[model samples]
Target: MKETFVILARHGATEWNRISRYQGHLDAPLSEEGLEQSRALAGALAALPIKAVYTSPLSRARICAEMVAAQHGLAVTSLPGLIEICHGEWEGMLLSEVEVRYADLIRQWRTYPYTVRMPKGESLVEVEERSWAALEFMAAAHPGEISLAVTHDTPIRTILRRILNLDQAVFWQIKLDNTGINVLGCRQGRWRVIALNDTCHLGGWLKAGEQMAL
Candidate 1:
């Protein structure tokens, strides 16, 4: 089989993101800064031979996907499987709030993410299964070509965990910045991570002397 490359990118900043809130499956719109980031992302990826664009159905991801697709003159494809992990009851809560209320579960989620299921939500295992399937489908549909997927942080992290053969225990260790780009290459029926959490494109948009904490 021919090698196929897929670029997985996290959506830009949202209001929830700035407040450190868990967005989960909630459909939050991108903030003003997020729009700028999305525009910058489109410009950065404009030079690539991107043939297709796939994104989570959620507006945040869709918005970014549209911008990128516009640059390549391609239509955006929304995939439900690429949506962010459902936080269940914790969806709209601030991270600090979840830390205080569901301290134990949060610890386990931070430690053994693969083992714990969100209350009324989903397990990391479930997330990996669905998102990977979506990604695989994308890769299979576009052999010897490049495609881009705009999704959330958790899905990107989980997908990377699988590609890099990393233990699920360190899931949270992988930090994904808003508009971060990750590259995956598939050859011989196997996928390898070519790049991870690359945010170099955001350099011009970032404030001078300000650092990204993602």
Candidate 2:
């Protein structure tokens, strides 16, 4: 096996996304726009020679992965590590409310996650470690095979940072939109980022910037 390429797909829009909820671990279905996003994403990936598929157990990610996997007659296996970070107390809080309640903590998270917690959530490192483990496991499980993983935003960012061994501040510099596809290829003990936060399929239909936050 020379290299293994994996496409990281952030699940399409969710109902909470429309209402601006935390949506960390709460399972919610995708909105109508999310469905359209999934369709477009599946169509965009239709040409790729995908061999296997993995998805977060969450409905939104699973749905998107299911549609894409259908194109190649593949079955999606839900990987627990691919699930979103467990936000604990902040699971369903609005970002604005978190800012008001955990003001200093939020600032510290934005600054450095060394001393921040979402009331009772997993630390940033916990998410970073587990998500990378998932990535490593996926690459190993399907060596030299083109695999696709459907998951959430923060986990994807954390995994990317791990692959690059980047500094903590690098987290803020990255952005992932709804139904966005990030392509990565692991080869010869190194990972290559082919694409990041790509949303060309919907023809700019994807919401960006603060709209990407949830």
The lDDT values for all models are 0.87, 0.85
Model 2 local distance difference test score? 0.85
lDDT of 2 at 150: 98
**RMSD of each predicted structure:** 2.6, 1.7
Tens-digit lDDT track of model 1 for 41-93? 99989999998999999999999999999998999998989999888989888
Estimated TM-score per prediction?
A: 0.93, 0.93
- What local lDDT score does residue 25 receive in model 1, on the 0 to 100 scale? 89
Cα lDDT tens digits for candidate 2, 1-214: 5789889999999878877778888998899999999999999999999989999999999999999999999999999888887778877888788778878877887788635667767777888888888888888888998899999988898888877778887677877888888999998769989998888987863455355235
TM-score between candidate 1 and the true structure: 0.93
Off by over 4 Å in 1: 204-214
Error of 1 at 170 (Å): 1.2
**Model 1 RMSD vs true structure:** 2.6
